[model samples]
Target: MGGPSEEPELWAFLESLHCGDILSGTVTAIERFGVFVALDDGPAHSVFPGVGFISFAELSSRRFEAASDVVQVGRRVSCEFLQFDTWNLEARLSLKATQPDPFQLFVDAIAVGEKLPGQVTKLIPFGAFVQVADGVEGLVHLRELAWTPVETPSDVVQVGDEITVVVTEIDRERHRVALSRRQGSSAV
Candidate 1:
C-alpha cells in the first residue's frame, strides 16, 4: 500500500539503486532544510517519490545561505540518493553520495599485473572514478590518467568516457585501487 500497486513492481526500480547511486530528480519542494524532488520511475505510472535532497553541507560551493538561493520550487535537479530509510519513510540523499568515497571491492579483485577497462564516472581536478565492474570502481589520479601533466582530469577524460587502466597499487585494507591510464594505454 505504501509503495506501489504490487510490491514486486517496485523491486526492479529499487534494485537499480546502489547505496551511492547518483541520479537526476525533479525539485518538488524547496525548504529551509533542503530541496525535495520527484524521482521518475519506469514505464509504470512514474511514481512521484521524493527525489531531490540537498543538505547544508552541499551548499558550501555556492555559499547558499538559504534554500531559496540554492533551489527554486518545481525545478529539475540532479542529486544522488544515498539511501532510502524505509522505517523513516525518508530518502537520505546528497550530491556527493554518487561516489560516496571508494569501496574495497576494486582493491580486492585487482592484482598488480592485471588490466581493466574503466568507464569514467567522474572527472575532477585531482582524479577520476572509473567503473571496472558493477558496484566496483578504481581511481585514476591526475598524474596517472595521462602520461603528461594534466591540470584538470577533464582535459584527459570526462564522465562516462571509457579508458584502459592498469592496477598499479592496491591497498586492501583501505579498499583503494590506484590505477594508471598511461600504463595500460599500450595494451589497449
Candidate 2:
C-alpha cells in the first residue's frame, strides 16, 4: 500500500516493517518534548514517530546544540520499532529502547588497577577527557593530573598526546570510569 506522497517517509517504513524489524534513522528535530528522527528506509526515506523520545544530553556525550553534531540529519542510527498505530498514523522509535548501552561495556571491558594508555582529547578546567581506548576514556581530574596541584592539564598532558593511566574505578551501575596516572610513572 506504499505510494508516493508528502509522507514518503512514513509509507516506506510501513512497507519495510515485518512486525519486528530493526530500523535506523537520523535526528530530524529536537523539541521540548523529545527528539524526532527521520527513519532510514533506504534512499533517504523516513517515518515520523509521535511518541518517540531521546534526551538532549544523551544526544551528545556532553555539549550539544546542533543535532547534526550528535545525530546527523541523514545519518542512519540503529533503532527498534516499539509500536505503530495505523489509525493515528504514527510510530514509536528509540535507541535506548532497543540496544544495550556501549558505556556499560566499559564496566567490564576495563579492569581496576590495570594500566591503559590514553590520548588527551581535551583539556578542561576539571581535567582532561582522555581516550584510553577506542570508545573508553576516564577523567584524570585536576588532582590526579599531577603529583602536586597543577594549574592546568596542559602543563603535563596536551591534546593529541598519549598518556598511561591506571584504572582507579569502573562504576558499572553509574557507567562512570575513573583513571589515574600518578601511580604509573614517578614524578621527578
Candidate 3:
C-alpha cells in the first residue's frame, strides 16, 4: 500500500487490471521499500509518478542485498498483478510471481529429520535464520538452537557461522522449515 492519488483517471486505469495479469512498464523509481513502474497502458498519476508498485519482497523469490540487485530504474519489466492497493490507488505487482519459487523446490527434495549444512545468516531474540539453500532460509528457534537453555540465538551461533541442522518439521502451506541444531549434533 502507498499514498493515495488525487487523479481519478489513474484509479480507473488501475481498477481495470486484475490479479495475475501481466503488465509491462518502465521502472520509474526504486525506493528502499519498493519499486515504482510507469505502466504503458495506465494513465499518469498526479501524486506518485507511477501507479504500478512492486514491494521488495515481491521483487524476487531469492534473497537480495538491495532492490537494484533485482531491478534498476529505467528498466522495462513485466510483472504479475497481485492486487489493487485502494489505499495508495496503485496496482500492487509482484515480479517474483512470474518466477519459480526455490523454497518449494527445496521442500520437495527435503524431508523431516534430514540433516543439512547451512550458514547462520541472522540472529534474533526469538530465533536464528540459516541459509539452507539459495532463497531457502529455515528458522532455528531459540529453544532449538541448543539443548541447554539460552538467552538469545547469538549465545549458540553467530551470523556467518557454519552449522549443521536437522529439519524437524516442514509446513508446506506456510512455506516454513523448522530446524534444530541440538538434534543435528546428537544425530552425528
Candidate 4:
C-alpha cells in the first residue's frame, strides 16, 4: 500500500471511531501547528508515540500564544473525536469541543442595538477591536469611529482607550460584532 493506505491496522482502527465520541489520551508532543496525543485505545503511530492529533485551532476557542497555553506534555485529556486524518494516519480530535464556547454564550445573551462598554484592544487601519467581555471583541470601523472624517482608527480611538459603542450588527455564523461609536454617543 502507498500514501495513507500505508497503515492498514491504524486506518481500520481510526475508521471505527465516530465524530463527537470522547477519546482519552496523554499529551505526547506540542508543536507550533498542533498537538499530538498517545491515545489510550488506538494502535501506535508509525512514528509518533500516539496516533491522535489536535490542531492549534481545535485546542481551544480562546486565543493563545503557544500550544502550552492550553495543555502540557504528559497531561491526560478527554477530547471529542472530530475526524480521521487519512494523510497522517492519525485521528483528529478537538479539546475545545469538550468545553463551553464562550462566543456562543456571549451571543445568546446579547442583542443588536445594545450599548456596551468596551476597551480598545487593537487598532488597525480600517478599524479598532474593542473587548466587551473576556475573549469577546467587536469591531468599530473607521467610519464609525466618529461622525467627522477620520484617516485612521487611531485618529478617533487609540488602543487601551475605554469607549462606549452600540452593537449595529451581530453575525452569528461568522462570530463577528459590528459596532458604532458614533451611534452609541448619540444614543446616550
Candidate 5:
C-alpha cells in the first residue's frame, strides 16, 4: 500500500520550479497589460487563468504596436520564470528572456564615440530618451544635449525629432546607454 499515494510526488513537481526555469507553454489569452499561458506539464495555478503570465514588457525584445503583433492566441512559447507570485498564485514569466536582448546586440555591434541616428521619443526634466534601435533607447543628458548650456531638454530636442548622437557610455549590466548629441556635431 502507498504511504501517502502520489500526493507528495505531485507536490514535489510543482515545488521544483524556480526562478529562471525555462518552461514551454501555449498562449491562452492576451490582455492590455499581459499574456496568459497554459504551461505544458505544469501544475495549474489556483488564482490565475493558467500556470503562467507574461507582462507586456516581457513579451519581446523588440517594440511592437500591440501584444497581438508579437504573439497570438495558441502560440507556443518558451518562457523563463521570473517569480512565483504567491499572493496571486501565478507564475510571472518572461518571453523576452528566451530571446536575445536587442539592446545587448546593439551595444556589441557599436563602440563608444560612434554616431548613430535616432529619434527623440520622450522628453524629461533631466534629459531626452532617444530610440536608437528597434527596442534600444539611450539617454541624452541635458549637459550633453548641446555645446551651449540648455536650461531644459526640450530647448535642445523635441519629441519625434531626428537626431544624431554619439555613444558615450554603455552599462551592459544595467542595460543603459548614455549618449551625447554634442559629440555628434562636426563643429566639436
Candidate 6:
C-alpha cells in the first residue's frame, strides 16, 4: 500500500495558518501588482515560489512608485498574515502591518493650525495632495490652495512643488488631515 500523498500534508499546514500570525519569508518575485514570498515555515506553493504574498498598498507605510523600492528579490521580510487566498493557495500578507503607521505618529505630534513643510504629491481639479511627512499626506482644497480664488490646483501648486501648509483639521477616526496653504502663509 502507498503512503498518503503530500497534498494532505500541505493542506494540514495551510489549515494551521491564522490571521495575524507573523511569517518570515524571502521575496522570490515582484510584480507590478504585488510581491511573492517563499515562506520559511510553510508548505511550498505549487503554483508560486512562496506561500506569502504582499500587495502593493500593503508593502509600505510610505508611498512608493514601485515594489522594488520597498523590497527586492532575495530580501527577507517579516509579514503579518492577513488571510488565506484559497483560490491562489497563498497567504495574503501585509508588510506594512508589521510596521508602525507614520500617519498616526504624525497626528500624535501635531495639532490643528500647525505649519509644516510639505511637497505636492498630486494635483487634482479639486485640490492638491501634499505629503507633510513620510507616508502622511494632507489635502489642500481648491479654496485653500491660495489666498485668492483659483481656477485649478495647478495654478497654485504642481506635483513636486514644495510649500508650507497649515493643519486646518484632523479626523483621527478616519486618519484624515485637512491642510491649507493659504492659512499657512497667514500663520507664518
**Clashing pairs in model 3, backbone N/Cα/C closer than 3 A:** none
> lDDT per residue, candidate 3, 51-114, as tens digits?
8999988999898999999998999999999998887788899999988899999999999989
Best by TM-score: 6
Better of 2 and 6 by lDDT: 6
lDDT of 2 by residue, 1-188 (tens): 23447556665555556645676666666666556666545443333342233555445344345655556444557666656545434455555545455576556565688988888888899888887754566788888888888898888889998888888877776657888878756886
Q: Rank the candidates by lDDT, best first.
A: 3, 4, 6, 5, 1, 2
Model 6 RMSD in angstroms? 3.3
All models: lDDT?
A: 0.65, 0.65, 0.89, 0.88, 0.86, 0.88
Q: Would you list the clashing residue pairs of candidate 2?
A: 9-46
Instruction: Name the better of 5 and 6 by TM-score.
Output: 6
- Candidate 2 ranges with C-alpha deviation above 4 Å: 1-78, 81-92, 96-100
What TM-scores do the predictions have? Answer: 0.44, 0.59, 0.79, 0.88, 0.80, 0.91
Clashes of 5: 0
Better of 3 and 5 by TM-score: 5
> Which runs in model 3 stand beyond 4 Å of their true positions?
1-12, 63-65, 85-89, 147-151
Off by over 4 Å in 1: 1-108
Better of 2 and 6 by TM-score: 6
Kindly list the per-residue Cα lDDT of model 5 for residues 51-78, writing each as its tens digit: 6889998989787889999999999999
Encode model 6's per-residue lDDT on 64-159: one tens digit a residue: 888998999999999999986766667899999999999899999999989999999999889999999888999999999888898999887889
Model 6 is weakest, by summed lDDT over 10 consecutive residues, at: 1-10
TM-score, candidate 1, is 0.44
Better of 1 and 3 by TM-score: 3
Name the candidate, 1 or 5, with the larger TM-score value: 5
Q: Sort all candidates by TM-score, best to worst.
A: 6, 4, 5, 3, 2, 1
Q: In model 4, which regions exceed 4 Å deviation? A: 1-8, 186-188
**Residue 44, candidate 4: alpha-carbon lDDT:** 90
- Count of clashing residue pairs in every prediction: 2, 1, 0, 0, 0, 0
TM-score of 6: 0.91
